[model samples]
Target: MTQPIVEMKGISKSFVGNKVLNNVDFEVLPGEVHALLGENGAGKSTLMKILTGIHSRDEGEIYVKGEAVEFNNPKESEKAGIAVIHQELNIIPYLTVMENMFLGRELKYGKTGVTNTKKMKQLTKEYLQQLGIDLDPLALAGNLSVGQQQMVEIAKAISVNAEMIVMDEPTAALTDREIERLFEVVDRLREQEVGIVYISHRMEEIYRICDRVSILRDGEYIGTRDTKTVEYEEIIQMLVGRELGTLYPERDAEIGEVKMKVEGLTSDAFHDINFDLREGEILGVAGLMGAGRSEIMQSLFGYRAIESGSISIEGKPVNIKKPTDAIDAGIGFVTEDRKEQGLVLSMSVKENLSLPNLKGVSHQTVLSEKSEKELVDDLVKRLNVKMAGQNQEVRMLSGGNQQKVVIGKWLGINPKILILDEPTRGVDVGAKKEIYHIMNELTKQGVSIVMISSELPEVLGMSDRILVIHEGRIGAELKREDATQEKIMYAATGGE
Candidate 1:
């Protein structure tokens, strides 16, 4: 057998007396794809950070290709042929793609110290082409879509000649087509004998791409198994340390009267949209990426302008020109991008939860801490949000907990109509089940829901009615009893 490219033994980490990882052992062979699976806060990130030199280990030993190494910083780790593509991308938005790719390692001419722009752009183009990414080298990073930005990050890693690459939720923001491209890149990298450490909550991806799987639970190593030899159920049991019976709970909410009506709704990204949401039913909006599903939700929630449309709530015509108007009309929106638009990362959990309904907990321009605390406490407990405290910064929470906080903040308003766009985008399977249960509970209370999801299974599993969007228009609508993956895809692709 070939020697392992990277090895870690007896690794442990802690923060302020809270142990995050304990006596973990991990290794990856050259050309091998190793999956690191765990629930949120299960020490996956802490362990990876120790390997990448972002955090110092409490006690551990690391070896790179039979040589002991100690890295004092990320730069040192990078120089040692280690690169990490973080879950949250690290590209500078305002810079050009080439500029961001060569950030901190610019090509320069001899003595003069002038940047060799031509050489950098040429190398950037070559790397992008090799990865099957079609992007302009001079385009602004912010102007590119999320998936494109992810590709750029991968290209940056390859440019560094990294022998071992760590990918943290690399496909969380990717589309189906983009995911295919990424798999192709992975195959090519494997042929080059590069090692990959893939960290994700997605089981399907792990099974499809990884050769071996390592399980972690509550800061301890459970076990490792060859991917082909292990059953899916066995891996799940090992990770969560229990049997998870069903991925999604059964839908039992009764459909009531129509609570929201849209006729001839048109926006820059979508046209001639029509849908009716009942009081206790989930109306799912399904589409391919850029099919205008999210745009429709944004327009309905008054975050975007509707060029032509008529909206009615409970038989009353309403003009919603802004988010405030939508809130006043008993509507709430949980946006698609939680980090950028849904929550303030720097703010406390209590602050974010009360941001939407400050007026209800304030009087004469004087805020009531008592009322705020009561409201936040009730919603947090109701959503089962795990947090250090109400005063803890929201950014410190895991992806699942952060999503719960976003949902809890919207629930504080007690709106009659709720729109959720990719509500479970970055959460784990357990958290997804919980969110679905919360939706079920909301419907039981007669709160109408409009869910936009790229995952077909999620739409088909939870929705009462499914609407397929194609090229900025509603292509088809199918009742839950009639909907199937084939029919939805056919319609979403503009099939006859």
Candidate 2:
């Protein structure tokens, strides 16, 4: 029998006397991609943290290659040939790719301490090429897109000579093209016999890549099964402890009159965009990576400079020069990069939610604490946000809950038009259903929506109409009944 690359038996953990994991058993073998499946707050992160020495396990036995071991810190795990590529990119935007690859461990001449930039850059170039990436080693990390930054992280892991790499929601920020590139990298790592602990909310990827699947539900060990043998519903039942039925909840809202109109909208990234969002309707925008879907929406919301455009709300023209202007125009935006644009991680939920609706929560120049509390309280309850309390730091909550905070904060203003960009990215399956339900409810109240998503299923399942953007232009307009995955792909790829 092949020795397990990493193993944990009878694993358990607690935080401030609250149990998070209970006797969970997990293991991975060489050249295997083992998926750790769970919903948000299901203890997947907790278990991985304990394995990497970020947290202490109350009970457990860990083994590396059948040798008993204990890692005191992440550095110790790295020394033991283990590395983690976190969901959050660790690249410093100002640093060059080569500099980021060798951060904190710069190569230097022996005894002289002179930095060896040439050798590091060469190594970085070679590593990036090994993964079939065309990124320039000298390029600034800050100038790269989210997907490029992610590929940089993988090159960093490979440079560490990692035998086992943990990937947490690796594709959450990626486009379909970038995801394909990532999968190719994964395949190469598997060829090198690298053990991969794949963590993600996406099921399709598991079917495509993972060899084995383990389930964790509310901190308890559910079971493990061969990925090929296990059915999708069975895995969902294990992770969520319930039959999810249909991932997309059936929509029951009616589409109505035009709520907002955009004509001849042009920006540096996107051009000649025109669309009409009807009240109580969802207008989904689908496109290839870098097709300028986000730029179009940002331009509409006054987050980006528009070269030429005409926007109207309820048939009345409005000049939106900035985010505040758009807000005043009754337009709310839940940006794609929520952590960077939507919410302040350091701030409490109450403070973050209150930032967007100060006008509604205040009286003249004097802030009204009463009104702010009412707004925050109502949103929390309405969103069913799980947290220690309203005052808890937003970063302390799970990814799903953090997303709700982003969406809920916008609701305080009672906007007529809402824009959700990659709304369910990095969120778990259960939370996704909740968000869909919320979207349905919002449309029921006559709040128009414009959803930009890479997930074809989500676009098809929720949108009343689909607009396929090809190279920054609307290539095709598809009705809900007419839109199919193949048709969207055809239009997105510039197939006229």
Candidate 3:
């Protein structure tokens, strides 16, 4: 049996009187991939942060290889052979791959301490080769795709010769091929006796790569079990404390007449895409990574430069050259990548809730504080955003709650046509259900919805019609009843 690489017991942490982690216990064995399963606010991130010294625990004890230690900072944790690759890539995009790998620890050759770029590149190449990863070390980090940048982070973690590595949803944005490559890398790391803590919402991945599983719910340890022995349903039951039954909500109602139409939509990022969204309908766009689903939405919303496109609202052709134009056309967009584009993390919940409704809050060129508060207060209650009050910073809220703010902000605009890109991405199961109900509510109100999602279940469950995009073109459109996994996957992968 492999030895335990790291262990924590009685781990409890609180921030500003809120108990984020409550007496959690976690463990990882050498050469094993231990999956940490939980909802977004289940204290998974907080527990990992405490382990890595991002935050000190309010009460707990940590043991590395049977030796007690307290990590005061990330650098110290790295020295102790532990590293973390977050969901958001931490690489400096402008720097070369080799430079990023050796950042803050560059090799010096002479008394003058001259940086040796060649040595760094050679070392990086060797590390990449170790994992059977082929790439140009001299290539700029920014030029690489999201998946490639993720590989760079893995290379950097390996370069440190760390004993344990924690990956937070590493394959969230990766393609099928990229995910296979990631699994291969994990196998290689395991061969090197490096324990791994894999955090992800995708159950299929846990069954594929994880050796053992640890579940946490509401900041407390639930249990750990052998992946080979436990079934997926059992694991989910342990994590969520409830049976999911059907993973997706039941669909009702039929798609109606085309309420919004796009023809000859062309942008530098994407080209020649056309689709129609119907009244009381949900049309889903499915694609692989970088297949331009988000790009199409951005072009439609007038956030990007559309070289050519004819957009029609309610069957009337109109011009939307900017966001203001889209707004005037009664279009609301909930962007993908919620952290970067969807919500203002620095602002309060009330401010973010009223973001898209600034015009409503402005009375004769002056901001109406009372109206803003009233609007947000009602939205908060309606959306069930769990916060102290409307004045709390959005960043302080959980991922699930923050998503509600984004939806509420757009709903307040009362858009006739809503474009939601990856609406439930990275949200917990409960929150996902909330978003689904909200979509149903909007459709019941005769508002048209265009949902772009990579998750096939979500696409099929929520969409009245599915439009699969491949190679910057609409490959096929299928009715919800006809949208099977095999059919959609075939279209998405450009298969006949």
Give the number of the best model, judged by lDDT: 2
Supply the TM-score for candidate 1: 0.95
lDDT by residue for model 3 over 299-407, one digit each (tens)?
8888888888788988789888899899888999998888899988999998898988999999988999999888888888888899987889999898878888898
Residues 1-496 of candidate 1: C-alpha lDDT, one tens digit per residue: 7898899999998899999999999999999999998888889888888888889999989999989888888998888888998888998999999999999999999778999999999999999997877888999999997878988988998899889999999888887788888889998888889999998877778989999999888999999999999998899889778888777678898898999999999978989988898999999999888888888888887889999999999999999899999999999999999999999999999999999989989987999999999999899989999988999999999888999999988899899999999999878777888899999999999999999988888999999999999999999999999999999999999994
**Angstrom error at residue 353, model 2:** 2.1
- Among residues 3 or more apart in sequence or in different chains, the pairs in candidate 1 whose N, CA or C atoms overlap within 3 Å are none
Error of 1 at 223 (Å): 1.9
The 10-residue segment with the lowest total lDDT in model 1: 240-249
Measured on C-alpha atoms, candidate 1 has an lDDT of 0.90
List candidate 3 stretches off by more than 4 Å: 110-112
